[model samples]
Target: MNPLLPIRHFVPDTEARVMPDGRLYLYGSYDISRETTYCSDILHVFSTDDLVHWTDHGAALRSQDIPWASEGHLLYAPDCIYQDGTYYLYFCMTGSYEGVAISDSPAGPFHHPVPITPADRDSIDPAVFIDTDGQAYYFWGQFHLRGSKLNPDMITLDVSTLNTCIIDEKNHGFHEGISIRKRNGIYYLLYTDISRGKATCISYAMSDSPLGPYKKGGVIIDNINCDPNTWNNHGCMAEYKGQWYVFYHRSSQNSKFNRRVCIEPIFFDERGYIAEVPMTSQGAEPPLSAGVPISAALACQMMHGLFISPAADNTTEILSHATNGSWAAYRYLSFDAPKSFSITAAAAINGGTVEIWADSLLLGSCLVTPTGGWDIYRTFRCPLTPVTGVKTLYLVFRGNDLKRRLMDVKEFCFYGDCGSGNAD
Candidate 1:
């Protein structure tokens, strides 16, 4: 589903690359579940041959390993590139200081990290792109986009080639998180656009030169409804199997600190302008099957106090602190003759009702009776109204107490004709 990693792992600001091993690698900053601000000290990488199945290569880098970095566990965002025989991991720490580390593998316990020079104190989010002629370019900064050629060492910047103010931040909606790629002789610059009064959108621009006066293309996706307090989106576009996809993240646990990686396929027009994509519960995965249980954590859109919180097990998540009129939506579920709707919930409040609607079709409604505590759960099912097509499912909750948490919800499934995994 949408949150690409486990509920326990909050990895954000992802940079994706299709490495030599024929697998796509994702490198990002890790967020400790309890933190209220941003990222933690450690970084994690995930790789996948198929977009649906991912392998977490844990702890690629740690703050403890970097002597120059501060002790406050504030590693923010990272990017990794494979050059020659070594994988270069680029990271930014609390003081906006940027550095590079090396490992033999794409997913690595990267070692011997060193901070870079020619990087301004306000630098963050280092992106590396190699051109068709085998020359590598490095990009970093906050509001102002900066670029330069990487030295043969792959760590040092070619100072003579430094280019600054490549994009007008205030005019082009540039906030941060610049990732670059080239296709068909056109350079694509993807960044977190400063629209919606915040950096919640991943937008792009196009240019003929590597560093230039680029033209703003359009937004790729927005991280709206990922969290009530969700503020930013940072990721990059990657091509796999001749298909293009945008990798981004969403916040969880009702807080902006606990963010998770998510992705969706993107389309390009004849002119190569990317069409805007909305957030989806299905993500890059297939339409959700009506047969098996779908985790409540897969919800891409949440409203009010409702959120996906980490469970006691730390592996699963619960739909928590749902107030009256609070709701969450799971996108694009394939329902083939669904007979009954089922829910697993634990309620402390007495008079709460869950009105299940399949994109306004009104499947059914069921009472969420108290199950003693938030940790406790029980399954409840109601007959569906013969739902049979792919639709977005909405769990519109109602209760007398407008601000009180009604129940904690978990996995839910439908009883019907269906198969396993993706649709056939």
Candidate 2:
């Protein structure tokens, strides 16, 4: 589903790199907050040979290990690059101070970190790109974008070569979290665009050179309704197996924290313009087969205070705090004459009804009875007026009390004439 990793893994502000090992590695800051805050001290790297399945390389690095960084929890955003058999992890911490860590392996417990900029220098969200002619460029800044050439050591920048205002809020709608890429000699810069008065859009800019006189492009993706608090989106662009993808994230828990990673396929037109992509439940893979159980936590549109929380099992998650008017929609599901709809739900009271809609078509509605407790789960089934073809799925909850919770939804699936398994 769209949240590329597990429900509890809050990985955001990511940069994707395809290493020589033939696996695409994800480098990003870890968020462990339930409150309104940003990053934690740890770094987690995930890899996937195939886009659908991912492998966690565990904790690759931590801010406390960096002897020079005084503010550990502010490990904002990171990017990795490979040069001459070594991998460099470019990271930024509090006060906008940038640093670099090294490891022989692409997925690393990267150690021996050193500051790239002086304590007084203002910088954040380090994006490193190497040009074709053997020159490397370092980019970072907030509101205003900055770029410079990195020294051969790769830890410090070439001071004399620093360039400022490569792109800015007034000109390019720049906010922060910049990722750089190039295609057919055209350099593209992806950053948090300030277009919607918030950093919810991933906008782009293009130039002829690595550090540029760039032109602003429109949005690639926007995370506007993913949660009650959709504030920012920061990700990078990558081409793998002749396909281009944008790695981004969506917020959960009805809070600014607990954001989960997501991906969507994107492409360029004849003039190389990238049209804005709508966020979907079927992310970097094909439509989820209706025969298999789909987690309720992978919802693409969570609205009206409907968010997901960890289930009592401590591993899986379930739809939480849902009541009347709190609904969620899943994008683009393949249905083949599905006969019945089933859900795993729980409630401490009389419960509620789940109105199932296939886009605008009302497939059916299931009356839910209380399971006596929110932690007690029971599967309920309702006969559906079967609908076919690929369509967006909507689950709208209706209950007597708007202020009280109706049910906690864990997982759900559709049954065809041939029958898929029960929702368990």
lDDT of 1 by residue, 258-290 (tens): 888898999988898999998998888789887
lDDT (tens digit, per residue) of candidate 2 on 304-361: 7888777788788788888898899888789998889888888789699999999899
Q: TM-score for model 1?
A: 0.94
Q: How many steric clashes between backbone atoms does each model show? A: 0, 0
The clash number for model 1 is: 0
Q: Of the candidates shown, which would achieve the greatest lDDT relative to the real structure?
A: 2
| Candidate 1: regions farther than 4 A off | 416-424
The CA lDDT of each predicted structure is: 0.85, 0.85
Model 2 C-alpha RMSD to native: 2.6
TM-score to native of every candidate shown: 0.94, 0.94
